[model samples]
Target: MFSMDDFYKSGEVEEDGWNLMSSGGRSNHGWRSQSSVCWVGATALCLGLLLLTVIMVAHNTSAINQWDSKYTDLIHVLTKGRDELRDERDQLKIQSSNLTQELEALRSQYNDVVDSRDKLQEDIKNLHRNRTDKSCKPGWLKFNNKCYFVSPCGTSKTWEGARKDCQQKGADLVIITTRDEMDFVKSSFAITWIGLSRHEHEDKWKWVDGTFLDGDGFWQDGEPNNSDGEEDCVELSRSATAWNDVHCNQKFSWVCED
Candidate 1:
């Protein structure tokens, strides 16, 4: 509310009072102004430096984000590769298992074939050996590595008559000991007299060699049943490997031994 002129006059008086003091000289006043200017400049510079720091921090944050993205991409690629590799390994394991099974099956088949081949070869060798052997005379049957001769002498004779005929020819009526011998004698295609007969007893058979018919070969299903208790001597049939007990005087081919 003071007037301008009064304020101006009061300021002149205050300046005069300050001039009178040695401490409040003109140089000191100029220094105060300069210090204030310097403070203002320093404050502005600090504000600018703070702004620059903020910008640098933002740029660095952006770079870090980019690096993180790159790392994520690399991880994704590696994971995908790992998955593919696992799939391939699984496939290979399956194939290997299949191959192993196939190999075992093939090995079993091969073993069977080899065994069959060996058996066939053995049979062929035995046949060849039998064909070349001289001890088995021609027209004579061989069985169990032994030779048998069935006489072709056609006659229906008594048990004594058949025995005498075989002895004169250095052989006896067929004395079969096994199925093989029985089969061989029957294959001769001649109805011949054998050594089996019931002489003094009924339902009992004896051999012409005077030996009891113990453990000797009998016809299949058992023969010399002596049906009606009349037939007593056994003879081989020409049609099959069977025996029949007929009358001792019946006319039939006789069997000699050698």
Candidate 2:
């Protein structure tokens, strides 16, 4: 709507060398100038907002990358720890196996030592028997390098009392081990107390000298039915190579040996 005539109103010039314009023209000019200033200010504000958005995006991307890096490091550390634990477990298993092998070796050595000790004991026993082969007293009979005495008939006593009497004579109740010894004792002293007995609740018989009976004892067939659950002492029978279990408190003649 503006024209050149508006700046040169009525083709006249003012006295101060300024252009004279009509009131309508001046108002239009001021409105155009204000519109241009507002447009430039709006464009500047849009550019500033765009730059701020880009800055925020860049900051967020950097933070995300940092977080990812930290997570990766944590995972690596956890994996390393797991591997170390696995190695440690394997070592413990190896140590356990080694310990088991050592224990087996020690047990083998212990068995060998036990065998050696038993042989030594047998040698010592043979040496002692050799030294005392001919050292029997008048009333004692010598057999197998040991002296034995049969209590006189009708000299019956309880098993405990018999052991006490033998102890007073520096001897103990006779221990019949071999079949020959059994035969000798059975022929010499029939129905006599021997050294075999057991505790009330025990099934194994031990001699009065604290030696356990070896192998099957010379028990009479079906004789030890533990009659009345009271028989715990062993007695030699008159029959050949047979023995019987009797009540410990029963009185009977006993054989003594040293």
Candidate 3:
């Protein structure tokens, strides 16, 4: 019926379709640009996170290495100290052993010294005991294991009579050989008869036991000068020298020894 008018409207609708195509092309280009910006931002964020992690790891590694070095040094120091202490302990043990040995040696020496002292003391005791074992007869004084009998007061005799009286007993007139004995005899008897006589020669003295007077009899100073030729017998003087020449018949107290 109206074919010509409808065909003209269809041509106008086709022109509007070109306009819609151009609007769609502009929308697509805007969306692609927004996606590209989002991707670039995400990539930059990841790269920053990686860089920070690397810095932290490097710092921690340096700190760990420092700690390890300190620990190693401490261990070395402790080990050295321990070794030194061990050495000192060993030295002390050695010293202790040496001291013990020295103490033992000293003890042995002390024991030896004690033994020597005991032996000496025993010997001395034995000597004194032997001397003490001797006893003097009645009415006699003892000196150096010898017995002496000093005549009592109011008793006097000639030298020959005294010697005979002593011979009746198992004793003789005391023959003094030491100064101590002479002193003892002098102390006991002021002037007494001894064993000295000049029976062989006028001036040569002899003992009653038949022994010659080799040395000078214990005479007083300048005594026995043969005051007279009759002075052949000898008597103890009051002087410490203990001898004086006297006549044979002179009577004086005499000494007897047993």
Candidate 4:
């Protein structure tokens, strides 16, 4: 609230153009009085300063609001992008899990198929082994790669009849070719006709295969007397050590060798 009089008198100075008239009247001749002009100029200056401050405040507020809107929009976009990315990542993980499960199923199936194939192959191999291995028919005795069939009931037959039966069935009477064969045959049969005969020539004993039966002690002590001069069929006797020359018509069970 400083007054113009005090403002001017504090320094107590004056311009030379202004003259103090003797009649006590102002001399600086402008349109308005100095106090009136000063009041108007001060009012205008205060009003201009108020208007400038209001404009600056309005502009700054608008700028702040625009920045806030842009910031909000940017945040929304970033959040949306993150959400989409997360969703896509979750879908990818689910697909991967499904694929892994499918692959495992395929592997299990493949393994099962392989196992089945192996089992079938093993069975085939076993079948081949059974077919290829050396063996005998049912009820036949195997010895030295040959099969022998003894009469089941010890039924008797004539020598010619036994030989005919053996020949008809694709076999032959047991021939005592080796010691083991002779022992086996003699031990197995009580009395059985073998493949020995001398029907073609007298006193010249021969096997069915035309081999001469030399005197190698293959007889009992008193065997082959050729009583009645008709005994030509040789048979394994009960002594288990020799053969007996018997009449060809004698009935006895025989052994077959194949």
Best by TM-score: 2
TM-score of 1: 0.40
Q: Give all candidate RMSDs, comma-separated.
A: 14.7, 15.6, 13.0, 18.2
Clashes counted in candidate 3 amount to 0
Better of 1 and 4 by lDDT: 4
Q: How do these models rank on TM-score, best leading?
A: 2, 3, 4, 1
Q: Name the lDDT value of residue 225 in candidate 1.
A: 60
User: What's the TM-score of every candidate structure?
Assistant: 0.40, 0.50, 0.48, 0.46
Candidate 3 per-residue lDDT, tens place, 1-258, comes to: 769678788777777787788789988999999999999999999899888889999989999999999999999999999999999999999999999999999999999999999999999999889778878878889888878888888889988888898998888988878888878887866788888888735557888888888776577788877777778888877655567888988898889877
| Model 1 local distance difference test score | 0.75
In model 4, pairs of residues that clash are none
For candidate 2, the per-residue lDDT at 97 reads 100
lDDT of 1 by residue, 1-258 (tens): 799999999999888888777455767898999999999999999999999999999999999999999999999999999999999999999999999999999999999999999999999998879755636557665565655665554435666687777687667777766666666677665677787878756556777677777854556355656667778878887576777887777656565555
Q: Model 4: what TM-score?
A: 0.46
lDDT of each: 0.75, 0.86, 0.85, 0.81
- Give the TM-score comparing model 3 with the true structure, all chains together: 0.48
At residue 212, what lDDT does model 4 achieve?
Answer: 83
Lowest summed lDDT window (length 10), candidate 3: 199-208
Best by lDDT: 2
Off by over 4 Å in 4: 1-134, 214-217
Model with the higher TM-score, candidate 1 or 4:
4
